[model samples]
Target: MVGLLPRFRRYRLVLLGLFLLLPLALLLGAGLGAYPIPPLTIPEILLRGEGVEYQVLTALRFPRVLGAALVGALLALAGAVLQGLFRNPLVDPGLIGVSSGAALGAALFIVLIPGAGALETYALPLSAFLGGLAATLFLWQIARTPWGVQVSVLLLAGIALNALVGAGIGLLTFLATEQELRSLTFWTLGGFSALTWPLLLVGLPLALLALALLLPLARPLNALALGEREAFHLGVHLEDLKRRSVVGSALGVGVAVALAGGVGFLGLVAPHLFRLLAGPDHRYLLPGSALLGAILAVSADLLARTLAAPAEVPVGVVTALLGGPFFLYLVLRYKREVYRA
Candidate 1:
């Protein structure tokens, strides 16, 4: 017991290191941009009183960078949870149509109701959150029957929802006006420049809370991964775990989709990558996935900002172009392993 306690403390220290590093990444992310503030000046500007540079740091870079980090963390965490729950490396929060539904809601607000000027900000995030929440609940209900629950049913429902939402987004795109279409297209692709401190304040704590809640469930999830019947024999409550996973993942996905458009594949990709580095223990897997996810997201955001110089490419485009090929590779690899077995 004494020896085990030391190892546990070491692991806890590693989690602490990750938590500390996140803020540093945000600081660096804020400093890298068109104007390209000096890294040293970043803290100075932030800590010092009001000035032009301070204004730029506080108003422009701080909010956007914080948003990038926060949203990236949320998406990656959601990906970790979803993949663990489904026991499918390909499962992402986006696969369940949550992000696309949010996109549709945001599009409706921006395009169909362009006249809503002042209220647009709150409306878009709220509508997006509602859309995602609705989709998650709908999928959950479909997967849960009176007899019991079936993961395959949930997987099928999510795939169907994704297809339907993608089609709806296309239709909305076709009907949109030229300017509205451009904005809608950009939103779908994802951007971080619209981030404000208020939004970050709202989202960051919820993300933290969600992580705090979900991290403890890692043991049950790891157990269920073996097989639910086996897990049941070992004293795991199937219903309780499922409900907690669905609710926790939904909250993370809803907040992330609301903030960052429909960024896909992070959830699917991050966990597998972490498993490769850190192995399949959910306790280690979850936090490792968080670290890798944040790295991927922040790195992608850096590319998005600099790749086009003054005009930024959407961060989603960067993630998608990279994640798409990676996902295909994983899928093909999984097929080969199945055939081999």
Candidate 2:
């Protein structure tokens, strides 16, 4: 424990740096758009609140940047919890079908509802949240046994459900009208272009609630890392932990998908990177993953917006491009470990 103290202190400093970097990233993201406000002037514009720069910052960039951070943090934290719970580094919200499930719900809403009205605005997120919860419950049921939740079975079930949900989304796509198809396409590609304050307001509470629930599980997760039987021997409530983590992750991921479309790989990449930096202690990993995920999302959004300079690539596309190779590398490097009991 004495030997570990130095490493823990170093890791804490790293986390502190990440926390500080977040605001800087947010400020930078706010300033780097089509109009290109200077970073130094951003505070003045925000304070004055009367000029074109202020309008762009407040009306456009601020909400989007804030939304991106929240969505990123939510997704990354969910990923860390799922990965810890399953004891598999590769598992993510998407791997377990929650994201696909949410996408299916969102796609269904887009295809079935035909209007830009209040009902449509609210209905999509509600549908997505329900879909994610349903999928999570289904996966839990499929993985449960008289003995305990089977991690292997859970992963397999998630893959199967993801495939099934993907098929549903495809069916929705096939049946959608032209405009709806366009909307669906953009959504799957994933961007924050459509983020608004109202959507943020709706999602914030769910994300925060999820975080609150998950953060407390750090110790239980650490105990579980010793193995389920051992964790139970140590008085960890295995069932409660599983239920809360899954439910919290589902709620957070559902809201993220509802708001930002299908931003992939942020969860997988962020947690893994933090694990490398902070070791696998869930206490640090969870919060560290959230910070790194926010940075990755904001950076990706920045590139997505400016890379094409008025055209804007999907943030999802950017994350996929970044995460795909890392995922492949993880598979190649850890295939044996992942397959081991």
The lDDT for every candidate, in the order shown, is 0.78, 0.87
Candidate 1 Cα errors over 4 Å, as ranges: 1-24
Candidate 2 error regions (>4 Å): 116-118, 146-148, 336-341
Residue-by-residue lDDT tens digits, candidate 1, 152-201: 89879988988888788788788888988887887788878778887777
Q: Poorest 10 consecutive residues of model 2 by lDDT?
A: 332-341
**Reference-based TM-score, model 2:** 0.95
- State the number of backbone clashes in model 1: 1
Q: Which has the greatest TM-score?
A: 2
How close is every model to the real structure, measured as TM-score? 0.91, 0.95
Tens-place lDDT per residue, model 2, 1-341, is 99999889978987998999999999899999777999999878878869877888888899999999988999999999999998888888876667888788788889988685778667777887778877888898998999777767878998999989988888888999999999789888888988888888988888889989888889999999999989999999898998888888888888888888889999899999887777888889889999999998999999999999988989999999999999998888797775783
Model 2: number of backbone collisions: 0
Cα deviation at 127, candidate 2, in Å, is: 2.2
